[model samples]
Target: MTNETMMQYFEWYLPDDGKHWQHLAEDAEHLKAIGITKVWLPPAFKGTSSNDVGYGVYDLFDLGEFEQNGTVRTKYGTKADYLRAIASLKEKDIVPISDIVLNHKANADAKERFAVVKVKPDNRSETISEPYEIEAWTQFNFPGRQDKYSDFKWHWYHFTGVDYDALHDETGIYMILGDNKGWADSENIDQELGNYDYLMYDDIDFRHPEVQEHLKYWADWFLKTSGVGGFRLDAVKHIDKVFMKDFIRYVRENLKEDLYVFGEYWKDSNSDIVQYLEATDLQFDLIDVMLHMNFFEAGEKGSDFDLSTILEDSLMKSHPDFTVTFVDNHDSQRGQALESTVAEWFKPLAYGLILLRQEGTPCIFFGDYYGISGEFAQTGFQDILDKLLYIRKYHVYGPQEDYFDHPDCIGWTCLGDEKHPDGLAVVMTNGEASSKRLNMGELNRNKVFVDYLNNCPQEVVLDEAGWGEFPVQAASISAWVNKETHLSS
Candidate 1:
């Protein structure tokens, strides 16, 4: 089904227990029942430490199998548990997508003496100091695995830089000038800082052939080892654009199975995302960050926000197919790094827009669906989400007609065919209680329509001309589907 409905399964603030994967395995059937076709998991491999949230990548091969970093299992779970979770999800025909972080590697085994150069954080191109000797923790001899997979050892040569220098006892960006190893930073990446290629801890040099082979090996190995449907690439802007394109190509070449790869570029500009798609020849679906920003802005402005401006600079307006629309993610949740929490009151409205719409692939965030852990208990969409999912899975159908006319209220209708007889109508208002006159075509004429969202709390009946007046509450939304339409997928 091409993952029409995607669920980002894990949130960043989840309790640091090595039991998440097991819990996810148990939650598989519920996910299927809730209309989730694809589930995206966080980084499975071992990070800097046992409690590390996986973005601080350590060993790609170690999926909680080794006794490294003070624990045998990752923060998620052991290797066996991770596999069982995927298997459980697969048993219900759900495609499991794993997160891939390739920009940097963290938690090295040993320190090596090397010549280093410091660069400005604002301007990476400008070398702030000359190359000086520093003991950088860049050696990686995977003592736990005992070289089970590829025996290629990582040293200062495989990477271009390190943050902490042991000998010098300084904390800054140090460009590693390995002996006889030329610097490899000539890839077209984010042009924010002239070149924002280097992101964090032990930045992998994409230009190096050996480094390239190792990453390719890991991608293929990961796919083969876990049999994951595809990947959700993390921090693509920090890595070389060419390298990312090649990695996807490599994954496709190795796995003859249909692979769906989408990357998180995380830019607030539609043009930049479109430009990255054009620049790398990488057509993978990107998370619509610009659209999320608009959603966030609308949530902040409340009734004052114009409904017409919602789709102004969104990828769904232009590149619909290649856009993965989401309300919030692990990074965007409250108290996280990209914390732009959508206002709680308007969450149902936001979820209604993404889930019920026909354009773009909608992703239900873990925090939004299941509620954020402990401290942020006030969040989550509650009963409205389950109802919306049912609507998205069953009622939403056919060719759409837009009625983005009013600044206060906007509505659209999906003209259903003979199979799904009475199509759907959606009316959303950012201002005080309003109603919109919309045509549902002759097929639905004189039929009783009810707001599935219950915000309207009123039934609408169409006239002989098929025109109906649908009303919604202030700063809320109303979705009108056929009163007799049965809920089934």
Candidate 2:
């Protein structure tokens, strides 16, 4: 089987012209040709406005179909356009995964008086003020939809917290006081900022039976309506773990059995992610954030960073099957809240480590592939990234051998398989030009190899023992492939 690759189909700075779905429909074939087997599309629902990047989710049922939040189309396009884009991807055998944000709701339609206590900004578990009456924007009536799909309306009682108190003209973490409303169990969530339950806007209280039923019904409705093959869950760490787990299981069993569900549990500690996995019973995959942090650190430290420890304490090393490795994403891109942009100088090396190795499933960032627009506009690595994708699709396979002995340089090789002959070699360096004699196996004896990346303009001839010395330039990566196989292909 060919190596599977996933691409984030949208960037953080995409134009708000509502043509993204149209562009995606047109670029389906191009994405398929570039060896992308899966695509994680941005949120398809209406945000606070047409320009909102979908994270500020206003209406769950509004997929650019209703005239809510001052627009009929989202940052992407209309609901029909979104469905068409999914169909186009399905036609090309690429699975479309919709980004699902269920942790909170934003842009409420009305303000309702509710009793709430203010919590400390640093520690959410500690209340800073007594419970008092406050008019908070916690009512989501969806005036435009008018209960078209579901008659359920969200009120202050359905949520656990709100960020802004409209009555008092104050802004803070106000924990909603109700009969049975509070943050999720601390044991099930990451212990960040005392309790990480409240993320933004009005935090959804999954403990409420009504809210739970509503979300489950919404999930079913969305799957049947959108025809997406999978879901990319957002803010899993801040959500109720029990509900999240049962929700995924319910969606898979009731909707589609093969529905792929991955979560964005953005934490750099492997132990924290392992705890989440354990809490959820390992039912889904998580984005390998520690590996991305390692890449960022390596790029920041240059030669001083130990390349040998790149994979240590990473989900890619601990739980490879549950890992979705990525170098950068919309959240980590420049100017974002979680901005930890990997140094561009080490991008080639970082890409090689994720793409060429036999470890976690790699995800190509849209910003890195198509370039970022708007305020922080930057050029992309399209030329080199395309070559790496081609190599990953056609040449990356078989038993792997690592040569991570040096701190400044590292290399690895995939012994060729029957289906993919003349296996490839990858070498990367941060300090200076270096070489590593990696074993290509006796099966690959006397096979001549050349740098498919074209970074090193030289070829290496394997000896009778199937050993070849691979060279890489300073602060760059070289992917060596069989010269004959590369030329023929």
Candidate 3:
């Protein structure tokens, strides 16, 4: 089966809470029951001092093994625990996709090259007599912190409007910065620089050939050791494009299968997404911004959303192969007050729109299925899991046909086959209750059909229109499928 036809297995954070291994195992089982074939987990490596959402990398190999909580090991348990998690998931045929941070390293206790030296306070020497000379550690308020410096001199790039001294020329091995830009621009710049609100130890010289080898080593280790099926490439925009191209190629060649690689190309426009798609193999198969604005925003702002035309136009014109489509993700939420609170009621509409259309591979967010609560109250994850899996199994893999959207009614039809003439049709309304005739003249007369959501059964009357009712709730989704065989009828 094509990747597009497979059901997406997604989890926001596996082992979200440190001691929830049992709970995670149970969640995996639930996902398996619903036909989810793959799972995406947050970073599982060692982070900085604090857990800090698992993005701050102290040692990628250690995998979060810290000597806290009675030497219990990592934040989410030991490497054994992670292996157990993956093994359990594998038993259910669920592929695990791990989130990886390769852009930079942690700043705390930075290796020696990053340490700033104290020249005579007023010395204005343009060039150091010995460029590699290490001066006394009286540079900043903190003294005798030599062990904190990294092995390589680090350079800071301008981020969040903070301008550092630009490198004009190369002096020996390291690039020399004139001076710090200013204090005002540097206030929150440190947080913006690193993965998880820590200063970066050193800006990786991706241009260096060794850096490429180092990245491949990590990739090889991750795939071979952890049994990961794919990767979610973090922070692609900040890294050099050439490096990404080479890195993706190396991974494609080295990794066992046609490994899935989705980069976080957070761009607002389709044009910008197109560039990233052209560069990377399969960057986010969904354009996150458009999904937010089109589905979530449409639901939030009201079913009579004015931006539907803009969304349709943009999606229809873009690169369809790499677009990963979804309603809402971990970062954003878009839906009505009641619909947002109760997400199950909203899936048939959102999923109906996404899976039925042929723009890109559809990704169902974890919250949409498992019914997230507390911090994730808006995401009714489990509420829609069964229904979504059913849709994926029965409808999504079928041959897709015309998708028509009217001012009041939006509908699409998916046929079983050209010769068979059996199929499913979904229609949604954004306005008052009305009965409209769908142009399904090709369907056989007296064929029984079922509305899966409501479990209401009806018969298709060809040439004579099949009647459907719009709910008084302004906007709602309904689906219908033909039950009788064309040959028998």
Which predicted model would earn the best TM-score?
Answer: 2
**Model 3 Cα shift for residue 161 (angstroms):** 13
Task: Estimate, for each residue in 1-489, the C-alpha lDDT of model 1 and write its tens digit.
Answer: 222798998888777889999999999999998888989999998998878888998899999998988888999999999999999999999989999888888989999998878888777777889878989889999888899887878988888777898996889877777654433344467877656777789988887888888887777788889989978989988877877887787667776348988889888888889988877675588888888888899999887888877877787887888888888888888777798878877778778778888888899888888787677654667589888888887767788898998787998888876566678888888888888899999988998998887777678999998999988888878889888763322
- lDDT of all predictions: 0.83, 0.90, 0.50
TM-score of each: 0.96, 0.99, 0.71
Number of clashing pairs per prediction, in order? 0, 0, 24
What's model 1's lDDT at 209?
Answer: 83
| C-alpha RMSD for every candidate | 1.9, 0.9, 8.9
lDDT, model 2, position 330 = 90
Candidate 3's residue-wise lDDT over 1-489, tens digit each? 423423333333433456443445667787676666767666676665433455555456655344421233345656677777778888887777777787655433322222222122122222233333221111111122222322222233221111121132221222222244211112111212221111133334455545566567767877888887778776655556666777777777767657776666554566655655665544345344555455655565554664235245244346666666666555453332223321344555677666555566566776565545654455454544455455555554346544344566666566554443455666665554433345443443445555555533344454435333322223666566555432232
Model 1: which residue pairs collide? none
- Candidate 2 residues lying further than 4 Å off, grouped into runs, are none
Q: Candidate 2, residues 218-314: lDDT per residue as tens digits?
A: 9889989999999999999999899999999898888889998889999878998988987898999999999999999999999999999999989
Per-residue error at 140 for model 2, in Å? 1.1
Winning model by lDDT: 2
